[model samples]
Target: MSALAAGQRTLSGHLLAWALGALAALWLGFVVVGFRTGQHEADELTDGHLASVAALLLSEATNDFADPRRVIPTSDGDNLRAHDYQQSLSVVVWDAGGHLISRTGDAPLPPFAIAEGFATLELGTPAVPWRSFARWRAPAHDRRVMVLLSVAERDDLAWDIGTQVAEPGLWGLPVVALVLGLAIRRGLRPLDALSAEVLALDVQRAAPLQPRLRHQEFEAVVRAIDTLVARYHAALAREQQLASELAHELRTPLASLSLHARLLRGKTADEAERQQSLQRIEQDALRAGQLLGQLLTLARASRTELAEAAQPFDLAALARRVVAEYAQAALDARHELVVEAPPSWGLSGHPVLMELALRNLIDNALAHTPPGTSIAVQLDAGERWLQVCDDGALAAQKPAPAPAAQGAAARHALGLGLGHRVIDKVAAVHGGRFEQRPAPAGFSTCYRISLP
Candidate 1:
């Protein structure tokens, strides 16, 4: 699976898998330890029993028989058949000369090749495979006693002991799994509720998501989400306010254009009147166009659309170019335009945005400043700052005192107009601000955009 797909799986699945895997490992370890312990215990008990039987039979032979090579009769078949354990066991005795002294119950001939101790004999058959213990009664007697038991019987006992030891855990596994599954489901209910809240959120309406989560683990995530939602709501409100303002600002020029069009259509009895009407229409159209352009610039500045057009360029050169482009307009307004900067200073940013900000500043100065006003465009290389300072009539106008209960949009509108707002936004995008203060002559306003 892809890494992303693997990561996207539920946390509960991973948790449950790990939990079950650990439990399984523990369960396997219990089974192994139980089986080994039971097997070891069975071996000790079986070997001890064989040793005791060999000792007892040797004692009986030494006491009862006068000849060391005498045979013992096992003719009482009823007594032998009554003992269940004896059916699975065999005993044999031999003399030093390899003569079989005595034997019982279909005992196989013991291999004297093995030294006196416990040993396993294959016997070349599946059913009667043997486990045997042998001992010499004493060196002087020249007799060997051998005791044998079936391997299958010992294995059966060991398996039974192991099963008894492991039975409880084996039976409890399903109950444990069920309990764990229920615990996991209960533990994840908070996350499920949080997910539902998130899914139900309405971005257009700027709705907040509030989930009653009991987990402290989700606190940070919830706080971050709430913060983002608040920011989104603020941005939406600002855009709505801007739209209302745009419509209000455009109404006057549109009404003027409409009135002039009617006048032109009426053929009002005189050439000069018709010419005046056309000029008025043209002026209103220009005003409306300028307003729309300013609004578009503001929109672009507010969003990331202009950021994609960013590139490294010489800021001083761009400033000089903008100054030159507006020089003719300054001349027509009877204003002096001056640029003070180095020949070149490198900067990385959206050049179009910088140009737009510069043009707006210069145009504002040209339109609002009296004739003979001097507008200066200054570039400071060390500070990476650009400033346009204009001595203008509008610059002389003092800001009105803010009302105590003024809303944010009202305060913003009071502080800036369409062109000024666009310039301010452009400056903000470049990590700077616009500044306006009284100059020594009349008044001075500066647009400063910090460059990187």
Candidate 2:
């Protein structure tokens, strides 16, 4: 169940998680900033109030000291305070002669020991703390006044005001999350639709996927998927065509071999006829073997993984070895074989597939061309290209490139035999292209592969 849940995790879920995490961090930051701002502003406002009230009380006093004006505004019309409001400002006054004067407000009279600036005082049974400011009247210097503010009251005021401001934001978090989640899910609907389209695709058909969305990313995805599906279909067609060709190519050789074998085994066989039948049997067997070998070689050439595992090898040396191995076959066919390459040319590629391609090219040149044809296997290290050129009537009769064909039989008739097709696939694996060009003066056509 846990594994299934993990697998079910979607893009929208991850997006929503990241967004919520960011919002939570922002909210935490806002709260920290708001709390500090509220506390700092509360302290400053209370300090200013203490200073202004003390100044006002001092200014309102008469020289005779008969009466003083009431500056404290604690008396509400309904005799009730605002919610969370608990403490009133305390006042205390004294003469410079050390005589007590007037005191007002609910808080107890602040002590004389209070200094000229702000101070904290411990008052009452459990010793509640008060913040006080004391100052003497200007010029007269005969009277001094002190105003007290409860520490707890100031803190409660700061927290209450800031909490009220931030409460709605906290309460609205759920609504914001709901909207964000819905937005993310709605935005991802295109992906769900894309997935459905892909799932509905058929392997038997090479239908192109239609672009259902104009989003840049989805368009790119559509293009990529389309390219992939096209390549898959092409590969599948090539495989089916190869199988059909092999089947068709095999029937003649197998039947010829069987017929020649029966003729040799028959009681009416003559010496000369028996020799011809034996020779025919050998040729048919050889043809069948060659057909089977081509099928496997083409299969290996089509494997893309071999290209990724390329290893460095001496290209020129490999060319020399392949030519040497085929030297007897060329002599048997009455063909002049040659190789023109540097002593050593370093390259990286699938050496096995490359050797197969070289062999195919040499075999194809000798098998399809007239006897005594001079075939040259030349490698141009500077250009990173190699070619097999033959001066034969077959190559001269066939143009450099025949018309493009889709079916295997069409390809064979057009001079793109199984061998040449193998070479083409091998070239593609090595990130190269195969070409047929006009041969040099002594040659009729050149089959070439060039690498980047």
- TM-score for predicted model 1 compared with the true structure: 0.62
Q: Positional deviation of 140 in candidate 2, in angstroms?
A: 3.0
> Taking the tens digit of each residue's C-alpha lDDT, what string does model 2 give over 1-452?
88997789678888999999998888778766776786787778788888988888889756344233543445545664655544578777788875667666656655676679888888877788888989998787888888888888887887776776667677777788899899999998888888888889886788878655457888878888888788889888988988998899889888998898899889998999999998778667767777888887887777644345878999899999999998887776666899999999999888888898898888778766755578999999998999999987753454433223112212222233678888988888788999997788878879999989
Best by lDDT: 2
Instruction: RMSD for all candidates, in order, please.
Output: 9.5, 7.2
- When summed lDDT is taken over every stretch of 10 residues in candidate 1, the lowest stretch is 405-414
Candidate 1 backbone collisions, by pair:
none
Q: After superposition, how far is residue 181 of candidate 2 from its true place, in Å?
A: 0.3
lDDT of each: 0.72, 0.78
Question: Can you give the TM-score per candidate against the true fold?
Answer: 0.62, 0.80
Q: Give the Å error, residue 143, model 2.
A: 2.7
What lDDT does candidate 2 reach at residue 399? 41
Of the candidates shown, which would achieve the greatest TM-score relative to the real structure? 2
